[model samples]
Target: MTYHHLTIDELTMIANFRDQGVKAYRATKLLHRSLETVYRVYRFLAAGHTLQEYYQHYRENKAHCGRKAIQLPTDEVTYTKAKVAQGWTPDTIMGGHSAVVCGRFTAFSSGAILICGPCR
Candidate 1:
């Protein structure tokens, strides 16, 4: 399974379980997590930290305001547009990747060859 960030509630639960004298194996069963996860939680608590502290640290480490816009490269755009005007479809412009061809065509329409690579 793909790893997901541990939730604030899960962290709280882990810390609370450890404080209640629950062993890591039993804690794992309760939390539906692996023993390693329980071990990490116990270690964190034993280090004199609280669940809130861990969650806050985690949030600060990964917090971002927003995603930056994706800009097409200038020369890539020019070349793609030129190729399109010369009767090349997005498929040909992309050199035959059907998935990429469809996405670019849908986004930019047929007239503009959307450059799919480095500006050259």
Candidate 2:
């Protein structure tokens, strides 16, 4: 089955049903969602958080759920900038053939490295 994020109206409805002493199973039937999904929503509401707050927090958490960014060292960045300013190609700077420099150059060309300027 396809995944579907619950809307604010559905969350409010679940909260209201839970407040009226509805069980998780019944709420699942009412919302046509899984029991786990219904229970999760009920638990979020029971914790005294509003639907908007839950959604905001959910979005924040979702934003962080991805491949971590590559972190180039400050010294490496400085070295790259110095070399680029001296009219050295990224390939020459990294000793002719380096996968790291190649990848970094690709990322740089795509605006990841603003200080490098336009690579020659």
Candidate 3:
């Protein structure tokens, strides 16, 4: 979706609702805007300063949704054996072993190691 900049009027409305104790999600619905947009503008207007600070914080937080991608681990002997039996290439085996590892471990906790291996 295309993201338009929050106008001064929209920011004012968000701040008014927040000051009146309206929740962020509900306020977003009331404004007919995305949840993130409402949240960023609420924080921006409430900070009692320039909107740029709020935009910056929103961008930073939005980018902080964890690491981009993870690699598999080489120490997983079971995965290695399975790959060998399947006659898969090293790169293919490494990238495709995530589902098997996730079955044995939490997807995020073991994700990096399972995708790239311990070497990475």
Candidate 4:
């Protein structure tokens, strides 16, 4: 199954379960989530921290999640776009391996090239 972040309600429920002196394992069984997943949120905040504080922290942390945006130099970006306009696929341009520039290689996915190292 695809991964998904926890919702606010789920976070609240986890906090509630923690408040009731219930173990994280019990919340995991009820929430159909892994123990670590439930426990992480349960421990996201300590006593005396308000729910809003939890939410604020959640939002801030969420901003750093998700796929990192593709970051290539302007020249590379232009070259890739030009190659793409000519009917070449990204994987093909990436050579199904690494884009070696000046004898250096940047790690990229086999299926997609998100970023390339400085080849200039």
| Candidate topping TM-score | 1
- Best candidate (score: lDDT): 2
True-structure lDDT of candidate 2: 0.71
**lDDT (Cα, tens digit) per residue for candidate 3, span 15-118:** 78888999999998888989987876676667686656665665676676544544434557566667667877556665776644433333323433345322
Candidate 2 vs candidate 4: the lDDT winner is: 2
Model 3 scores worst on lDDT over the 10 consecutive residues at 111-120
lDDT of 2 by residue, 1-120 (tens): 567777778888888898899898998897899899888888888888888888888777777754455655676677777878888875576674353433645446655543333234
Q: RMSD in Å for candidate 4, one decimal?
A: 7.2
What are the per-residue Cα lDDT tens digits for candidate 4 across 1-120?
Answer: 676777889888888988898899999999888898886676665656777787888789889865554465566656666776798865576673354332224423333344644443
lDDT of 1 by residue, 61-104 (tens): 65743343345666666676677679886567676433242356
Error of 3 at 111 (Å): 56
Name the runs in model 2 displaced over 4 angstroms.
1-34, 87-102, 114-120
Ordered list by lDDT, greatest first: 2, 4, 1, 3
lDDT of residue 22 for candidate 3: 95
List where candidate 3 sits over 4 angstroms from the true fold: 45-120
Span of ten consecutive residues with least summed lDDT in model 2: 111-120
TM-score (C-alpha) between model 4 and the true structure: 0.52
Off by over 4 Å in 1: 60-71, 77-120
- Clash pairs, candidate 4, are none
RMSD of 1: 7.2
